[model samples]
Target: MKKNTIVTTDTIAAISTAQGEGAIGIVRLSGNKAYQIFREIFSPSKPIKKYQSHRLYQGSVMNGANTSSLDQVMIAFMKAGKTYTGEEMVEIYTHGGSNVINSVLQRVLKAGARLADRGEFTRRAFLNGKMDLLQAEAVLDLIRADTDAARVQAIKQISGVLSEFISSIKKKLVQVKTNIEVLIDFPEEEASPKQLFDLKFILQAAHDEVMHVLKSYDQAKIIREGVHVVLIGRPNAGKSSLFNAIVGENRAIVTPHPGTTRDYIEEAINYKGVKLVFTDTAGIRSSEEPIEKLGMEMTRSRVEKSDIVIIVTDPSAASRYDEELSIAKEHKDNVIIAINKVDIASKDQIEQAKNAFEDYSVFPVSAKTREGVESLVQGISGPSLAPSIENAPVINRYRHKQALEHIELSLNAAINLIDQQAFPEIVAEEVDSALAGLKELTGEVTSQDILDKIFAEFCIGK
Candidate 1:
């Protein structure tokens, strides 16, 4: 793979804080000329020949003409090799008005600092060996995390827990590859039974570890990216009422009329530290109206893409029981049957509804009264839908998961080759391939295009 070379010759500046009014905003600069640019634009309250590193000074940012002060600010100078990007850095803190922040940034730019690119600061940290690619991604995850579970996972990754694990796996693969190379070099020497057993044992251990990590990807994905749930049923089935009950707000319109919801209404909630996005789609029914037909089409598409499908039905809709059951059958793998309006339904009706959906997990709930709604919520947030793996590091990104899968495949090939007593050269090649995948996962070797794509997702000021 071709590695991208990083250059830190010019100073880069950007507004570090979020846009808009606040108590304070920061303008950050990093590179060889960071301090030089700072000196030109700032006039300290107390005149000093040399500035102290890592110390904040009261100063006023000078205007472009150097005729007057633009804003009163506190500036800090951090010497190279100890800052976030491992280069000389400067941060100017000013009053957080949009105009003031913009003026300060423009002054720094006029002093010979180029505007920083998206995630360029963090990318510099990665290239400077301050942190690995996994930690850099964790920084982004932590910034965007909306749930406590996601925040904890990002913290673990940023602390190097996942990097250490990947490194340990790579170390094992390298050792096994070294042993295989020795065998290949000395073809005249016959391999001992003990040596072959040891090789197979180590390879198997690595393969099993990869499998275990791969299993956590689903749970990690749910925590990082909120779950997608779609409520579906025939018209006048109380789907809208149940949606409001679950969201604890009147987000969806509810009327006695059928097909009230012509499109989907979505709302998100945090329950037990997991983000659940519930989409209330239009009711599914045979309709001659063009708009209703379009709404039904959108409902089918959402159901197909949802992580969980709640098939809502009530005793009042007993006549359409077959239609609801057919919909459930289509998504049997992730379908949950909810019997809504139990408060109004007679005991016999509730019992019959349960018996009809006996093959699946059924919850009898009164959306109007919120009776048994907690049980339904529990069922939706159950371990089957989102497993708890808090103690270990998880691979949340698709890139990481795909890389681990390739590593697993390569290790399996090596193990099979060993069992067949294949040539040492062939086994060594497989081991090398697996090691390369591990390297790619931690970014020891990666193409420039991949790096560009990963960093492009970040905001410009990041």
Candidate 2:
């Protein structure tokens, strides 16, 4: 369908609750004929001779022919222009149960209502001027938020903080573009030096705004998708012990024998309202055993995907994990050196371990005694826990990031043309391209395929 196409011609119905037992289940309908279709199957306790908007009545849902009741329900009606979809809507509140909800839904379908597609309700809201693309995307983010920090970012996006910021930038660009077009329309007029300077200034400001939003995608990604942390070290380096301590459980088996852990163990924990998924991989070693070799390969793959690598070191075998240390050093920003078993290590042994990895920040920790474990967790999530993040506009999706890049590119081209003293018409062309990028970001410029991919991410009945 086209971006502006209104989708309220046919009434749509769906079970708006989870597919299990609960306190209540809601069956929602929206379209021009919603009230008419709902009245066909719902019988009110007191006669509802006249249809009223925003009124609830006790009723029972009946079969298509209105002969037998299927379930007890309380039905509500909302007239057009004030509903979620900006069309007539009705909602049926029935007892929570799969059978009861399905039966009532079947009756509604049989009474000329079609089952709703995934995210059709919210899509309608966007098409009806209720919310923009940014807010619509936030609904899914809010639903899938795994931590308090992620929830805060999602709520800010949904509240139009990012949208309003982008709007302000776009409004300034529009004014600049209009003045340039006016100059182009009258070729006899030579643009003044002051006009050229002002144009350059506006373009630079827009470019800076786009770059500012782009800078936050990395931090937002960590909040939206939890950070992946992997514990890697040589055999019997206390990798398993540190993993268990961090997760607050004995999730991995502890053993004195080297190569006891032949596979990787994964667990997630919320640290300072941010999520950290820790994985305990097989200890890195020069083992020729087939199982140990295969486990090492998997460990390498996990390390490549992980956002943080905790290279645990045992003071007794200080020089044994040089190969693992080399690997961690390759990703300097993502590596955290942890000296485990510090409770038993002597002063010389601790000094030797720290000196071995002097290039990296090393933390002396004892997983068994829980010493310095909290500091390790904090070190793993560097800069993300800063309080300044609360006030920044976070771009949580790749879609938004790409749109900002487009705007930046367009503004750069326009600014270059202004510097070269190019024709006003050519400069206006670049401005128009930048304006289109903003429109696409806010759903003003979109296609059917784009709409389908975005809404498909949402759960049904949203």
Cα lDDT tens digits, model 1, 42-161, are: 999988888999999998999955579989999999999788988899999999998999999999999999999999898888777788888888889988888888888888899987
Global CA lDDT of candidate 1, please? Answer: 0.87
What are the lDDT figures for the candidates, one per model? 0.87, 0.86
Backbone clash count, each prediction separately: 0, 0
| C-alpha TM-scores of all predictions | 0.92, 0.89
lDDT of 2: 0.86
Runs in model 2 deviating more than 4 A are 1-3, 64-67, 252-266, 282-301, 343-347, 386-392
CA-only RMSD, every prediction: 2.6, 3.0
Q: Which TM-score value belongs to model 1?
A: 0.92
